[model samples]
Target chain A: MIVIGSESRGSVPNTSPNVRDMAQVSCCQLDEEEFRKCCLQLLQRSEELRDGWSWQQPQGSEDGYLKKTTLRCVSVTSKRSKKNQQDSALLIDSDCRQNQSAHVSAAPEEATDDADDEDVADDADVPACSACESSFLQFEYHVVFSCSYSSPVLYFRAFTLEGRSLTLEEVWSSIHPNFRLHLQENPLNAVSQQEHPLLGQPFFLLHPCRTEEFMKPLLQMAQQHHRSVNYVLSWLSIIGPVVGLHVPLQYFSTVCVKDPASSSNPG
Target chain B: MIMNNDKDVLRDVWFGRIPSCFTLNSDEVTEREAEPYYLMLPRVSYLTLVTDKVKKHFLKAMRTDEVEEMWFEYEGTPLKWHYPIGVLFDLHASASALPWSIIVHFKSFPDRDLLHCPTNSVIEAHFMSSIKEADVLKHKSQVVNDMQKKDHKQLWMGLQNDKFDQFWAMNRKLMEYSTEEGGFRYIPFRIYQTTGDKPFIQKLFRPVSPQGNPHTLCDLLKEMYPAALTNDGEQKRYQVLIHGIEPLLETPLQWLSEHLSHPDNFLHICIVPVPTD
Candidate 1:
């Protein structure tokens, strides 16, 4: 089942060869040097990404070793607006029913948000909307280069506003329903808590074993089109949305202006 | 004879054990003094997977309310259960005396230094992920990707149950390579050092040189960690240990990876300061 799902996911980029008129080149895989260069380009091109993400070279590591890019305290607001509040409420309601003790404390505000809406409506002049009762989650994401896969793996951890870490269930609930379905379809490559390679802290990471498998076709299309794509930007644009790290469309537009020097360089 | 030697090395690496004593922390409110538990820990196994008996023994002395998730500490450092038992020992307490003394804590779990191991499933997931990562380095993940889910389970269950024959039966496939390629595409290894705050050093390293010369342990150290090696006539400052023994620097990386790797299939080398005595 997973194999079929991954194959279909891999083919999505192949079908859409002409994503944009912009000349964006992508690499099949990145070496350490290319990863560093791409990270610089990502930060330079995108201001929002730059504010959150910083290159962290672990102390005591020798020069030329792989450095990680980290983005801390990124706020992802999952709004349960009036239109979709019923669906979301049902989801949370079922969750509470199944695991009453475990999830009640973690999502008390969310569980009671609907009930409190009446009181909030009576007290406030403005119309009470579910958006006002939206739950906010903060995520810390690290982009570390995997030498084995020759790709950047995303390691992240989500926390509540009160500083408690979210369990895997809570994290899944926070993901956008669309991306959640796709992630659920391919559970093997889905987010899992693992020890951080550099920090030794438990952080959730998307397994990179299949990254090269899915990325090859996407990169090849860009290469064949004679477009110069930033590997990190292209990869992140596809993956980041699944975990709420949306790469602004402006990043692509800015990077689309081809640099003459990089264009001439061979893959 | 060469094959026999290889088998013997693999057996020796698999059977390596560390004798340990687990004593409850002094501050815990116990009904009575907790008896120190002694056990021979399997070098390749994870601490969380094999220490249920130790947890049970210590829990008997303490009230249920007083107890929390159990954690282990050696000296001042909290032992990370995710690391192989041997790597933890060699990295932190290699020079310590026999019957490695470990403090068992029932309270104040160090969330910063340790990952919570609530169940064996966590260990299994971590163990499988590691093998998958290692395979990506070895054969571009071809061997592991082609494996049936049942085959993967056999490897994990073997390690969990301490069955050498069951593990090697499936693992031998992951270690194979074409004669033309000579060795694994890249040797999966992590060089650990005690002095650094860094977790470990991992990078792409080929088991064979471009000229078809096999890379030895010395060649790897020279490229990745030159500080671990000593110059001729210079005093040796560090010992390069695999499976708690210093194999000759001339030992081929391919052979060591094949025979000396833990169940997770990575060559875990600890570069510790040599004992002055």
Candidate 2:
């Protein structure tokens, strides 16, 4: 098409409308180093439940009867999936959570190098795996279910989470009947002495890194553009052919469906 | 142009051809963590180009060695010539996606050593006017060859699956349904390959395949230059070297002319006729 040099002031020929729209959208550039610092700052501000995990104040409940707390899965992914879809949940050991709490309470300025030893592969070419030697295709998605060393019951629904919208029943059905997901963040339950106490049943471990600073703008971009994070990723991927060159960016968003149960439905 | 002494030796070293690892910066590493070689060392490869008019002026300015000291603005920010080489490389690489930067010089040429010299080396001359007709005939032969190579069912399946679409599309009529048949005659630039003093017309038009294999570009170039070419009176004396020749409705003819003016930027390698004492 005779696309020459860096600056030609015309519409690129053969360019799709969706691709051109994405090229115009701007995104925040976050490197691995910046991500690490943001994560560490969040951990220090909240109460650490263990080495890599932390909890914040259990806020007022949505229904007034159910209190909600925020769990920051640092270097850890909260197994937030149903039992059948249990591979997606965050599995935190009790000792790890206790250690996390102790560390958070200490108010240590020195961030530990070994806080939650989970490795997340940020590249599409490479897949995240438990072991380094596994093939790229061999890696499987894991889910976090409620505490069961035996018949592992999963409560977090994975399907509804895909586009970020779900009904209260969808969330309720996904949760184990024994464990109620309290909106409160206090690891120490004030009503621990109550009969038929909820223990071992896992609540969805929401990521603590959600300051809205990173996501709010991304959501705005997606909404204003009528696109999804998946759509953006797909859009960015096509930039190679546009100018007849390859340009890679660090920041990208994933199209997410909020648990209609959670009320942040993207759709 | 005079970054280092012994220009002849440097030219010869390039002519010998080092491995692609040392030259092009495309070696496979164990973990894709950091490209140590690309990050640390300068990947020096001979980017052979034929110059036009305006580019020749810029080259002359660069050779005066004053551009290296001049404080010029890039993207509105004033940057000096001696800023890290990485900065220029990075910006250019990223800017590849963006439109080409229009260089508007407000000042005069630099006052350094005049080491820059223009050679009368020949480069490939792709006559954009002839490509459409030639491509049509070439594809017809290719289709005949493919039929002989494969059975009827396989050929039908390949066509149905859009496998041969690019090949056919390249040779197809662009204005088939238009009232003005042959409204846009697809003419490609004549590409010339130059080595030392002599320039040769390139036989292969497209360096890359539709499947995106970069190695194929190298392979095509290698196939075109099977043996080392020496520049002598008996060999071919090529005409003016040009860049970005692919014929379109509007030609950025100035770009080629601008690049040709600068002798330093486009070093025309020519064998010395006499050994100076």
Candidate 3:
């Protein structure tokens, strides 16, 4: 009933599971930089379809066959900063995303200078149609890369793949059947279009609050466990499809890699 | 302790024995394909559990920093920590079923993380089964000294007799020895064995329902063996007992789940016919 792992401060500990860090301690402990490097590796691997975070989408056939066009969690990133700005640059990235719909270069527009000092909420919340200048921003689940956290989050915006981004209707239709209800209720997945801290665009963010809970154990494993893991690939493998991004596994083996150094007895 | 290692008889299918049941696609992905985000859980969630070593490996494999509880759940119920994958598979005819699905919770991501793995996971199950097999082999043999054996017996008897107070009174002694492990805490695992089948070792922690209904062993049996209630019935009835003592028929499963949360506690199924007029 007490459910140990209280992280008791190493004194005359009340319970064995109650170490000072066990409850809060992560099994893996890579820092931000190290995590970034790991994610970077996976980002590249996912691009080449070398990592296992993606798979080929099968076609309808009498004779089974897999198409070369694979269904994978593509690691998407915006250029670093508004030339080192912040979420405001991400704002242009979102616009660039809209421009993508018109076959225009999605490069962050230079017009988006630091004039963002005004009430960002004045017109920022609504994504305007680049050509129309009146239509609101249509955010799609573009899926983003975070340099600081070195993790991939469910970033959404308008003008996704196939030129234009998924319309709200398309997004609603494409959402995983199981995740739809929770997507509505999960405060974490709630649609909060804002400027990305690094990309500076009005992208819909897959809330990171609840995400922290899941990452805690993973980080600890990176720190405590002996085997090296591709934290980004794992994160995408675990979180990508929430909005329907399917990443295939690269190493298609069924072996649990054991640390030759750490295995004796776990009693 | 009448262990039935179905692993031998039902091994090949798991090792790629083409079933006479259906033809397969050589190029296309099967029901169990390589998926990154989701894990495929077995239809029987309560059936199997991963070993700690593999649990660590699985966490590492995810390549995420999400905090994962060292436990896996099926429909929100955590599997007992001690269940070896083979034992769980045997209970569920897994060899024939081959490759049951696995469930991994994204612990920190409460809302979106809790998911039913879309594709059945091979690496997780393989890791679990292999680690368990290895652990079993490593011990080769165990000597629980006569004194400890007697102590264990008393504990078993207390369970058989349904003496909750007496059983726990002595359980502490066993736990004290393992406390130096990280801190003195209750061990994980609550196993249920039944006379219905000879040592069909299965573990599932059935938490109480919110409306206040304790899921009991009887409920589990009904769920596990649905055909037991025949439509052609002629006054056929059944009784459920734990250890040897009949538990209160309506005893909430939550009660059992809580009382037997420890790794050592076991509920062996011992069924017998009660006399009737």
lDDT for model 2: 0.23
Candidates by TM-score, descending order: 1, 3, 2
**Clash counts for the predictions, in order:** 3, 78, 73
True contacts kept of each: 0.34, 0.00, 0.03
TM-score of chain A of each: 0.61, 0.23, 0.45
On residues B1-277, what C-alpha lDDT tens digit does candidate 3 reach at each position? 1013522311221122111111111232233432323233221112223133334444554534433333344334343323333333333222243234435443422211122222223223222222222211111111112125455555555533435456555544332211322211211222333232122323222333334344555565565543333335455444333322355645554344323222233333333333354
List per-model TM-scores for chain B: 0.98, 0.18, 0.27
What global local distance difference test value does model 1 have? 0.72
What lDDT does each candidate get? 0.72, 0.23, 0.35
Query: What local lDDT does model 2 show for residue B146?
Result: 29
Q: Rate residue A199 of model 2 by lDDT.
A: 22
| TM-scores of all candidate predictions against the true structure | 0.81, 0.17, 0.27
Docking class of 3: incorrect
Q: Report the Cα interface RMSD of each model, rounded to 1 decimal.
A: 12.7, 33.0, 20.7
Q: How far does residue B132 in candidate 2 sit from its true spot (Å)?
A: 38
